[model samples]
Structure formats: C-alpha cells, structure tokens
Target: MGDNVVVSNMELERLLSMKGGKGEASYANNSQAQAIHAKSMLHLLKEALDGVELHAPNIPFVVVDLGCSCGTNTINVVDVMVEHIIKRYEALGCNPPEFSAFFTDLPSNDFNTLFQLLPPMANYGNSMEECLAANNHRCYFAAGVPGSFYRRLFPARSVDIFHSAFSLHWLSQVPESVEDKRSDAYNKGRVFTHGASEITTNAYKKQFQRDLAGFLNSRSIEMKSKGTMFLVCLGRTSVDPTDQGGAGLLFGTHFQDAWDDLVQEGLISNEKRDDFNIPVYAPSLQDFKEVVEADGSFSINKLEVFKGGSPLVVNQPDDASEVGRALANSCRSVAGVLVDAHIGDKLSEELFLRVEKRAANQGKELLEKLQFFHIVASLSFVL
Candidate 1:
C-alpha cells in the first residue's frame, strides 16, 4: 500500500476510534479528562433537555450520544440526561415517557464493554419491554449504534436530544491534500496542526469545516423539530489554527520526538513518521461559529470556550514520571491504535514508551506546555 492509502475518508472511520476494552490503557480508564469536560457541561445538557418537547407517554423519548467511545463517561452523560429529563417531566405533572439511549461511534468501538458497564439494565435493546423489566428504577433502554457521526445514524426526526464531548474535533479522515505526497499541502514532517505550514494548516481547517457541516446537516435531519444537540470538543483559544498551545499541545511535538527517537535508532524510517498525520483538528471559536451559522439548520443557543488541563493528565501531581506515564497512557488510549495501524504493534509500543520517558524527563515543563482549551455549544433544530 502507498503511504497515503490509509488516508481515505471511510478508512479512518474504522481506524481512528479510541482504543477499546477495560485495560489500564483502554479509553475507558483514560477518559477522566473527558469526564471533567462533560461534567462541567451537564448544565448545558439539562438546558437542552429543558427545551425539548417531551414525547408522549406511548412514544419513546430518544437520546443519542455521538462518538461515544466505550467508556464510563458515556454512561455518566446519559445517566445525567435521563435523570434531569425525568425531573423536568415530573415537575410539569406529566407521565415520564420511555427513554431510548443510543450510544454511537465507529463500528470497531467496544460496544460489548460499554453495555456491560451500564447500571444493570434489564436487557440491552430498543424494546420497551426490556426497558421495563431490566430494572424498574432505571427508565431508559441503552443500545449501541456503531457508525460515524458525520452521517445520519438515526431515522428522520427520530432523535429528541444529542450529546457528544471531546469528539467533534476529529475530522472524518486525514485531509486528502495533506496526505498526497506530491501536493504542496502535504504535511511532510508534522503529524498535526501545530507548527504546520500555512498550506497544510488550511487543509486541516477546510476538512474540519466540511466535517462539522456534515455533522450538523446529519443531526438536523435526524432531530425532531426543536430537538437539542449539546457538543463539547477540543478547541483552540488562538485565532491561528497552528497555535502550539491548543491541539498542538495534545497531538503535536511530543509524539514527533518519540518518532525521532525511533528514526535515530533505525527502528522505523523517517518516511514512516512523515507519512502519518492525526485526523483531528481543534477548531477556533470563530471557525465553529462560521460553520454552524452557515449551515443554518440548528439555531445556536449557547457556544463558548473553556480551558482544561492537558487531556492526558487531570490534577498534575508533583510526580513527573507519574504524570508522564499518565500522558503516555492517555495517548495510547486515543491514538495508540492509529499508531499501531501505521507502524505495527511492537514499534507502536516502543514509541509510546519513549513518549513516557521523554515526558518524565521533561517533567513540569511538559505538563505546562500541554494545557489546552475546549469548546462547548448547544444547538436546537429550527424548521
């Protein structure tokens, strides 16, 4: 296969989901950084459910979590949504409707693990009977829908509410121009937006805009009129897409340094490092607004930027090696699969080990450098 063959738009849908299972390196264990953002945004989620027109008692009240990698954070979000929504209906003296929660990601996601983690559902499916029998106290039925969010997952006007966190920044694939070796826009040495050339950066920006628009368009079609979407994802504070403090901190130099170590040792060729680029782009606040406003389907109710600790480490304890290993595990959880796809398992393991050592030796300096921001927004469909 050619260097850029893996860059196909559909191919990444299979390749880029967070690593699966319940291991220490699984996304399930390494997702606290994501949980922090989702928890902070629960108010917005409640705000969204507040606006939704509750389904009739006979109809299921549908909620969908887009890009819901197999993790507890996914369940926590749905639990909060179900709880707050039930409260809203009760306050209005209405019979709470059956709830159907759909957890969606790529087909390769660990749905089995996610289903096992749910709070003792009677049985997992869309059946209202299962919802009633699974656990009398739990009112919702949970089912995993495996697909990309850039396209429609549910039927037209079927979903009443949607939630996604730390997911939208991922483009459907590496931008084609960036992967084409002959193109000036090729991301030659760099794997991500930070420190990229203007041409390479523009490719990433355009891809994000297209993907976000597709996401909104799909949701608009699938959502009931006035249905709500609450989204939270990695974002950049700087106007410049290539700013080091934003996505660059999360996806840029540290991995490159590890790749450099492999190259120096002749374990992998420099071209192997140069050929791969992470298919994620942290949009600026302006970039997000422009796409949503242009799409003109979902009326933006709330949009704002919030900063967070490095997505890798939450508290940043005094121990450098500890933080370093945390950072490495975090990367392994999200991108280790992609790296493994590119180079192979053994080399990918070696590469992340180097990342741990490098971050440990660099210590507090590395932690400070990786601080990044998040974008949270709530939108309601408008006919």
Candidate 2:
C-alpha cells in the first residue's frame, strides 16, 4: 500500500478447507497426495516423538493438530503420534502418561461430522481409560479446537508437539488491496495474484508475510522449550513467480481463464472477479526458511521439498470429456464453496464444468506446466 499498510479481508474462505464430513466427496481427489505424505509423516513422527522429553515429567503429553479438517486424515496422524509417544515412555520403563490431542480448524469447519467418524475409543475423558483397560497401548484422548491458527490458541508452553498439513498455504484472509478499487493492485478480471501485475503480487506477498509471522509467533508461545513441530504443505518449486502451468492447481492461470469466459457470457461481473482473490500463497522454500529464522523461536531440524504431481497427469483419461469431469470435480471439491458465495452456485457449477473442458483440452500441455512444491519441515522450539 501507500505506506506498506496491509489490510485484512475477513471474507476469505476460512482456510483451504476440504468438503465437510466422512464422505469421499470431501477430499477423495486429495487421497493420493495425502497418502504419499502420510507414509513419510510416520517416519518424521518417529524421529520427533523418540527425541521428545516432557518438560515437567509425567504431565499429560499434549499434541495439537492445526487445520485438521474432518478428522479423516487427522485420526491417522493422531493415532500414530500417540502410539509413538507411548512407545518412548514404555522404553524408559515408565507408565504411559495421559495423552491428549486437539484437532483445530476454523470455527466454520464441520466438527460434528468429524466427531461422527471417531471410534468410541477416541471419545473424550474416560474413553482413553477404557482403551487402557482393554490393553490398548496407545491410550489417547481427543477433542476439537476451532479457530484461526494465525493467532494464539493455547497457553504459553502448553503444547508438546504441533502438527499441520496441506493447510498452511492458506492465508488468514484475502489481501485487501486486490479488492481496493483505488489501488493499482486491483486485479480487474482475475481471482488471484498469480498472473497479476507486480503490485498485485506484492499485495499477496505482504499478506502472506504478515499472516505467517503471526502464526509462528503464536506457536512459539504455545510450544514448550525443545518441543518439536511437524508441518507438511504446498509451496513454490522455484523462484519463478509465473509458473502458471495447469499443474499449478490453486495458483494456475486456467482457473482465471475459466472465470473470464463466464464474464464474457455476462454471468459474473468484472467487479466481482476483481474483488475475489483466493487467499493462498504458493511460497518458495526460502520464503518459509526466512520466516522461521527471523522468528528465532524454532531451529530447523529438517526441511525437504518435493514436486507435487497431479493424478490427472499420472492417469491419462481416455478422452477430454473424462479428463474434464475429473479435473472439474477436483476443483469443485476444494473451491466450490468460495465460488458459490461470490457468483452463486449455478454459475460456479457451470464455470467449473467449463474449466474441466479447458483442462481436458490443455491435456498433457497443462500437465507439463504442473509446478507445485511439497514441503516437510521438522522444527524444534528454542525457549
């Protein structure tokens, strides 16, 4: 802005949320990438848990899952983390400490559906006791905590290990300048800063920096000294900002192209298109490290970045129609709600279908343009 002034847009989609509930529609498209990370996450969990030491011995071993949507992926993560922590206690000839896990997300998340998926063993309070009585080695307790992770959610040094995945790329809200008609950064016919001018991109960049700094500051407060955190999420594979390949998924140009067609059809107003910017930032690995090192609250234990390949690319469909359908469903699953709010459901559906056709036609071309960065960072809090 005129003075590096950054404004907030509360109308954001409240995190890169998946569909609510236990149904496949919630995030079936994400299953492949998530499964790939899950296997790797277990090894990270082993390292983090084995090396962890309770600051005050015998206190409840606390864990928090940031952005745990619907408990599908979270249940597995929580179960594995709890089991490993217990194994550490057993190795030391100590009785299993009371374990508590909190799954946090935005207040609007469908926690009811998430709870429905939990077995009686994960019910709060005496549930872990019952599991313990039955000789379940991983006696653990679970609950939901709903809020924006950009702010403080727990007391100082209250958490032992914090975990988040596929969620951190979501900015707390859309950048305000993108919606500011008076600002040169106004993206007159786009929905993100991806292909916009330098001003527009700068706006998104500032917003990301502000939100991430806040997130790290809050976590440093909640995490105890020597506590470890495991984070896995999407990022940029290179310093090149204009990697608008079809594979960019959330950050690609095709998304705006699909929306532009609707504007031509007079279904969506130019003003609305300019006003709606997706609250996401595909940051480079250096971007992440810079923020962490500046905060000085955590030491980087390990960091790795992988190229995220689309299932659409890997599994070539028989025809464009089939490809269109698959890509459309995938887009709808992640972004349907936001589209519905801005342009109404009817238009959003039509728009995504058109996007599908576009993706189908783009074919291997879009696949080649796929540019996504998957980051796994293991951090240790330095009190």
Candidate 3:
C-alpha cells in the first residue's frame, strides 16, 4: 500500500530459512505458536494413524517430518506420530515394528541445533535388547534431511507416514512475473500478496499451484502405497487473496513502516524493498482441493479451515507492548534470515526493532487483528 518502486532479481532458496539455534530469538524458542497448531490437529492425526496398515512385522516403520525447522516442536510432532503409529499396530494385535524418523528442511536450516535436542538414540538403537530395556519408548532412529520438500528426497515406497506442519505455505520460490518490471503483475512496494491487486495475487497463486503439485508428486513417489500424509499450514478463510481479512496472513502495517523508515533515511533504496517478496502463500480450502484432485496421486481424507489465536494474544498481556514485542520476535524467527540476506544483518535488526516499537505503540487493537487460519489435511496414497 505504498508508491510503486523499481525492481531487481534475487535468488530465493539461499535466503529462505527460520532463525536457528536455541537462542532467545531463535525459532526453537519462538515456535510455541506453531506447536499450538500441531496440538490442535492431534485428534485427526490419531484417527488417521488408526487406519495405517502395518507393513511386514519387524521392518522399521518410516516417518518423515517435512520442513522440520530447528525446534522442539519438530521433535514433539515426530514423537506423537511414532507413538501413535506404534499404538495403531498394537491395536491391530501386531507387534509394533521399529521406527525411523526423518526430519527434513532446507539446507540452510540449523540441523546442528535440531540434532542436539534429539533424545539419545542409544536407548532406541537397532538392538532389540536396548529397545526392550527402554520399555520400547525410544524405538525410533532420527536422521536429518537437508533439502526442499518440493523435490524428491526419498527412494520409492520408503516412507510409511509423512507429517509437515506450518511449512508447505512456502513456495519453492517467488514467481518471476511478480518481480518483472515489464509484467503487469509487478508487486511494486508490497513484500507479500496480502491485499495486493488481483493480477499480482494470481501470479502468486499460480506459483503456489506449481509448488504444491511438485510437493505432492514427490511424496507420491517416495511414499508407499496406502501410506498416510498429514499436513498443517497457514491458509486463508477467504478465496480472494486480496482480502485484508485473510487471517492476517503475513506481516502487518508495522513491518511496512519499518521498511519505509529505512527508505526515508536512505538506509536502503525503495527498489530494494520492492524487489523483496516473501515466498509464502496462504491458499483457500478450494485452492488446495483443486491442486490435489488435479494431481490424482493421493485422495484427500480430510481438509478443513480452522482459526487459531496466538498465546501472545490469548493469555491477555497487561502491557500491549509486551505482546507486540513477542509477536515481532516470532515473526523475526521466520523472516529475519531473508531480511538479513536482502538488506544486511545490522539494518535487518534495526528494521525489526522499529516494527516492534510501532506495533507496541499501535497497541492491543492492532495486535488482535493478527489472527491466523490453519488448513489441516489428511491424505493417503491411492491403492
């Protein structure tokens, strides 16, 4: 919602990542909100696991967590999946098989931190004696997979269950047309397609369609027949990407003001801000259904849109600025890397500080508007 600025090209993959490590500002600490989303979907996940047909006994039951940013949230989801899977086998009167959990993310992801948080595998080692001694709780071996989910990451029929949370909204890259100066869809001053023009929004939607298709097709090849996939990601309550009430899908006005401040001070050019577009999209339920049906690899078991309120807002902070700062930190955990890559670390830090300050000044009313909508889907490969 600012003046049109010139454009430039920048690679997306090298910059896309969550803030790593266990530091106060890292994704591990800021991801409680994401953890909440995972918790809300547990019932559906358990129901899906109940129907999982156990493979030959004694073979490892493979589970993959796609887009597993460095955090306990990732570990928590894997634990629930593995534990439920084992329970499913037990309910079927079959001995639970060993488990393999693969945590996958971009190469830029901080795998070191993720591994450090993993429970000791000595208790869950391949040996049956160790597994029994540990009371069969720690029966899964963990591995880090550094790559994009849009590309194939596993061998055919290898994975038994796939779980991804708060991840798939990220497109493999921003659409080139939106950044092209000569194109009609050039996004101009906006960093995301929240209330952008119909043309600009359509460009992003097309990119999302391609990205989602690639993701599903890759999993179809890697996952075994009849395997299950559970996904949770940001989505829109409205079909129109131009809708401002699209669950406050991305950063709010405060973030834009921060960038404007930089531009006014001549710290960064307006063109630079224009060039930066976050490679994320929140599609409506209809958008998701169309893509899956067209792909024809998996049948959708359940797909629904649900609202989630942040703990920052839900707990009711007495100081509005406290909630503002908390919300900004959560955003920085995901967007800081990209901002730093585009405008250097010093400026990026200053920008986020400005955002926090502005958001705080705006107070409770503004922060409350930043609601989230989640699309939870359960799908299985066609037999």
lDDT of 1 by residue, 1-383 (tens): 22333334566777777899989889999988778766766776788778887767778889999988988898888878887887777787886777889999989888888888878654434453345445533567778898889998999989999999889988888888987899999888777768899888888889999999999999989999788988988887888777746567656777778988988998877788887788888888899999999999988888988876667654656788887898889888999888887887888889899988887887787777777688888898998
What TM-score against the true fold does each predicted structure earn? 0.92, 0.86, 0.92
Candidate 2 residue lDDT tens string, 1-383: 01112223554545346666544335544455565556655776678676566543458889999988774678778888887776666567666668788989888687887787666553335543355455433356778898899999999988999999878877887777777789898877777666668777777767877887898999999987788888877766657544423335643566778888877987766665666667777677777888899999988888877655653433554566666666666666666656666666577777887787887886655555554557788898888
How many clashing residue pairs, candidate 2?
1
Arrange candidates, best TM-score first.
1, 3, 2
**Model 2 segments more than 4 A misplaced:** 1-8, 13-16, 22-25, 28-30, 55-57, 122-138, 244-247, 311-316, 363-371
Looking at candidate 2, the ten consecutive residues that score lowest on lDDT are 1-10
Estimate the Cα RMSD of every predicted model relative to the unseen true structure.
3.3, 4.9, 3.4
lDDT of 2 at 364: 59
Error of 1 at 376 (Å): 0.8
- lDDT value, residue 238 of candidate 3: 78
Candidate 3 per-residue lDDT, tens place, 97-213, comes to 778899999898999999888877645435544554564254678899888899999999999999898898888878999888899999888787776789998988899899999
Q: Flag regions of model 3 displaced more than 4 Å.
A: 1-10, 122-137, 244-249, 311-316
Q: How high a TM-score does candidate 2 get?
A: 0.86
Give residue 272's lDDT in candidate 1 (0 to 100).
82
In model 2, the clashing pairs are 247-370
Residue pairs clashing in model 1 are 122-134
